[model samples]
Target: MTETLDTTVAFRATMGRLASGVSVITTRTGSTPIGMTASAVSALSLDPLQLIVCVGNHLFTRTAIAEHGRFAVNILGEDGEDLARTFAAPVPDRFAGVAVDDSHGVPVLQDAIATVVCQVSQALPGGDHTIFVGDARHFTHKSASRPLVYFAGEFGVMS
Candidate 1:
């Protein structure tokens, strides 16, 4: 009999080696702000200014995105590990005590390396996650700082 490999473990380990930029994907339901740490973001296109973020079905942000139809992608800087952890945690207010500013009426991390405000162009099912494709409406970036990176299931800076 052949021993079966644990595909889940193997897949995670393999994907963990793929370094990705860390970001906070935020969306709102009315006055309530919801966000989470995510590294599954991609620039899908430039001509149409398209971007994509994968959100797990279990996250509240997933429902917010579907209801509000808009989101902000805040690209974390090297010093944003604390913020990343805060967002990733099951906190009551992820934005509590966190400075934020509005972009196209959506809340974005204050002084983030980059922020993109987008409208939900489409949402597709990606296995257990939902792929939210956004049409970039507005964006801003400042400061020449290194980005926060996720690799090997840990946060690191590209140095």
Candidate 2:
């Protein structure tokens, strides 16, 4: 038998027990670029090389992703708090002067531990967000740095 429950308490308690890697989601439209710090990225497959990103339904970045049909996940390392803060804010033209480009023409931040470029395969409605499934087309990695992590509502450095 299934029981109904409120998400307010359940979500917080459940999230409290989970630790996630931090990433900066970046996208571009022509020359305009936007970025956001998120910890909602996850791997979905290996054979077909798939990844998933949960974007808030109401965020401008989500609209950008839908319109552009592509995005880059910049896996941040332990020293990425500054990058995280800048992206998480409503700052104007956050990618200005920063070493980045459309690796797949999708605005990937430089110096990230890894960059994954993908084409959105599906977008399904999921509570307060939309789950975007991406087919990984290209990827790059730098194995020299420890990853940045997020847990219990705070940022952490991987040890």
Candidate 3:
């Protein structure tokens, strides 16, 4: 037990040093939208245009993505720290007062630096998280924006 706890703590500390862009993964169940802040998102393939996002097992957004079969990754800019914290919090109705575009059937943040709509292609087990592999379907980006980054448990912009 001690070894497991030590490893977990060490793992988190080591991973924290590696900066990552922040994003909001969104999906819908009926007309209600669900979303969560995420940093464990990455491109998995280019040939098939795939992306991978790890969702915690305890999050309801994980189940929503599984059932909905689609999701949008809203890449946050430096101006999006508040949006990140809002979705990360336990607040009910994270979308309240937030502008969104649901044209692709998945809620996309209008203020995001970039947005990628994807169709879920595979779901794999990843320790305490579910690894969702998605096929890119639609995408939009703003070239001039700076990405919101997360490192050492704090949010910032790239130097």
Candidate 4:
């Protein structure tokens, strides 16, 4: 048990050194929007425009995404630390006072550096997380904004 715990700690510490862009994955169940801060998003293919997002199995957003069959990845800007914390926390209303647009059938963060709307193509079990493979349908971005980054247990901007 001690060895397993030590390995888990070491693994987390090691991965924390790898800088990654932060994003908020958003989806809606009927009229209610659900979102969560995630750093495990990546492009999987370009031929058919596919990306992958990993959501923890325990998160409500994971089930929402699976049920909704669509989601948006809001790549946050350098000024998005507060927004990141809001979505990452267990707040009752994460969207309180936050600007959002759901015209595309999924919630999109209006202030995000980039927003990608995707239709879920596949879902694969990935250990403690669900790997959602999305087929990009629409996207928009702000050319002038720098992305929010996560590294070593902190939020930062690329220099």
Q: Write the per-residue lDDT of candidate 1 for residues 1-159, one digit (tens) a residue.
A: 433578777878999999999999988889888889999999999999999999999878898998999999999999999999999998898898999886466789985799999999999998779999999998888768899999998999988
lDDT of 2 by residue, 12-57 (tens): 7788679989899988766688788989999999989999999999
Report the error of model 4 at residue 34, Å.
0.2
Per-residue lDDT of candidate 3, residues 1-159 (tens digit): 345888989999999999999999999998999999999999989999999999999999999999999999999999999999999999989999999998999999999999999999999999889999999999999989999999999999975
**Model 3 Cα displacement at 35 (Å)?**
0.3
lDDT of 4: 0.96
How does each model score on lDDT? 0.91, 0.86, 0.96, 0.96
How many clashes (backbone N, Cα, C below 3 Å) per candidate?
Answer: 0, 1, 0, 0
lDDT of 3 at 136: 98
**Candidates' TM-scores?**
0.94, 0.89, 0.96, 0.97
Number of the top candidate by TM-score?
A: 4
Q: Name the lDDT value of residue 80 in candidate 4.
A: 99
C-alpha lDDT (0 to 100) for residue 19 of candidate 1: 95
Off by over 4 Å in 2: 1-10
TM for candidate 3 is: 0.96
lDDT tens readout by residue for model 4, 1-159:
345888999999999999999999999988999999999999999999999999999999999999999999999999999999999999999999999998999989998999999999999999889999999999999989999999999999998
Ordering by TM-score: 4, 3, 1, 2
